[model samples]
Target: MNLILLYPEEVQASGQILSLKDRRFQHIAQIHQPQIGDRLRAGLINGPIGEVEVLALSASEVQLRWHLAAAKPSPDALPLELVMALPRPKMLKRVLQTAATLGVKSLWLIHSYRVDKSYWSTPVLSPDSVHEHLCLGLEQAGDTLLPQVHLRKRFKPFVEDELPALVAGRRALVAHPYQAQDCPAPAWQPSVLVLGPEGGFIPYEIAKLQEAGVESVSLGSRILRVETALPVLLTRLFPLR
Candidate 1:
């Protein structure tokens, strides 16, 4: 980990000493290889960005003195919310990390007709695993904010019930391979972009999403994996520069 992360509860009195005994200790000792008095950027999960001075280390734990000033705000909010088909465990980890890096404000992992049912049972869906990936992404970009993630196990009900409220005034685009418009330029208003499974959205799924006011759109004629297509969509829709 480039930067160490702590939750609000981890910060001790005087706000100077923070004890880390979790995976972060291993990352610092083995990966970062910091010596005593080595200062590293650190932050609370939903709180502030600050600096930590390494005070001591052992095989399984590290102690640091923290100095927090102000928390860093997110770079920018994409006018986009991602509603994606559940990808495999490995891909899910990568996508969640990338989405956090890209400043996606919200993510909905929904079941789709083509999605593998087994993907829902992955341990990666646990709170700690998800937080780990988000922290990695945040550290990658020197960011402090975390994205909100939602899980939807039923495709039709999500499209019919939860989706309408989320997309009411926002432009909604569904990425499909055929007979759809191209992804649009980022506008002043927020948007919601839906992506399909590895095999793409089935007809009924597409129809239901459309019925809920999601417009069909495409990256191109060529198909891309969910991981590849997500970053492309984020970059295309919200060009950084």
Candidate 2:
């Protein structure tokens, strides 16, 4: 982990001291193996990035002094919302982590025609499981702001009832292979990116998205997997300076 993520609740009652005994402790004890006076890069979830001075360290737990006054704000979040067809469980884990790492503040995982019904029943979708993977992503990126993930089980209802408002004033683009315009210039403004399932969205679904104000766009002739397409599209939509 590039940044040691500390939750607000984990802080001691004094607020300036924090203690960790979870996997983070294991990581620090094993990987960092720092002396008592050493400081480590750390951030509070949805808070600031700063250093934590090791006050005490042991096999069971590690105590640190939180330097909130010296902390800096986390990186600005991308002004984009990612709407994606829920991939299978295995791919879902990677997608969640990648989305978080890329600074996507909002995510919608919806059903698509090609999406397997069995995929919904996987344990990876559980709240705890999702939080863990997202944290992994945040730790990798040294970011603290957690992305909000919305789940939609019904495709038609989501498109017809909810999607229009979601894309009302934002530039919405749905990635499709057939008869699609090339991905537009890097959009720094508020936008929505819709990605389809393994085989891509069916014609009717694409039409529905179009009706909802999501224009069809393509990432060239080479069709990519959902996991591969997501980061590529996001990077193109909002490239880092």
Candidate 3:
């Protein structure tokens, strides 16, 4: 974990003091091995980045006094939205974590013909699981803002009824392998990118997305796994800026 993320409930009655007794404590105990008065980089979820002075430490728990360092502004999130056709259950977890780490503020997990119906029933779809993976991403990137994840099991309704407004006045693109326009250079404008499942969107699905004002774009001739394509697409569209 690049940053020790703390939630509001962890704060003591004084607000400045925090008590950790979960996996975070184990991390401090095993990985950091910090001592009393040692300072660690810490941040409040959805709040400012700062440091925590270790007041007490042990294997089961640790107490730290929160200290918000002035002049250290929390990084701004990317002005982007990712609308992806839900992938396999295993891949979904990794995708969610990557999304959060990359600073995608809005994530739409939608259904497509290529998506397996059974994948939707996985336990990872639960709020707790999704939040956990997103937190892992935030902690990795030293970020605090959790990306908003939306699920749409019905593909047509989301594309026909709700997508137009989402893509309106923004650069909207959907990944397609055949006869698609080449992906564009990175621009710091609000954008919505739709990535398909493993085999990719069916012809009908692509048409539906096209009708919703989403232009089909291609990465290359080589077909890439959803996991590989995501980071590549996002990188090409919006770099390390």
Candidate 4:
């Protein structure tokens, strides 16, 4: 982990020595192997970025002084919200991590006709599982804020009822293979991007999104997997950010 991420509840009081015994402790002992007086980069989730000075180390735990006075604001997240058709369980884990690492502050995982209903029942969708994946991403990026994930299991109701409100007054784009315009250039404006499953969204789904004010955009001739398409799309959409 590039940054040690601690939640508020983990540290009961400020200015006190904190002990870590979780995966972070294992990482410090095995990977970092720092001597006393050495400081490691650390951050509090949704809080500040700083460091922890090693006070002592043992097999069971590592004690550190939480010198967070130098803590600064976390890096800004991308000014975009992602709307995606949920992929299978295995792909979901990687997608979640990539989205978080790339600074997507909000994610909407919804159902499309091609999406398998069984995929929703996977343990990866559980709150703990999602948090674990997101934390891994934050640690990799040295970021403090956790991305929000919204689940919508119904396709028709979500597109017709909720999506319009979600995209109101925002530049919305839906990735499609046919009848699509070239993807727009990256900008700082607020935007909502909708992408589809492994095979891409069905025609009717695209139509509904278009009716809801989302324009259709294309990547290319070749179809891409959900995992591959997501990072590619996000990077293209916010290339400079």
* Top-scoring candidate (lDDT): 2
Give Cα distance to truth, residue 166, candidate 4, Å.
1.7
> What is the lDDT of every predicted structure here?
0.83, 0.89, 0.87, 0.88
Candidate 4: the clashing residue pairs are none
lDDT per residue as tens, model 2, 141-175 = 88999999999999999999999998989989999
- Model 1 spans > 4 angstroms off: 12-14
* Cα error of candidate 2 at position 198, Å: 0.7
Candidate 1 residues 145-225, lDDT tens each? 788899999988899999998889898889887779878885556888898989888998888988999998879878888
- TM-score of structure candidate 3: 0.95
TM-score of each: 0.90, 0.95, 0.95, 0.95
Ranking by lDDT: 2, 4, 3, 1
lDDT tens digits by residue: candidate 3, 46-79? 7777888899986578999888753155566887
lDDT of 1: 0.83
Report how far residue 45 has shifted in candidate 3, in Å: 1.4
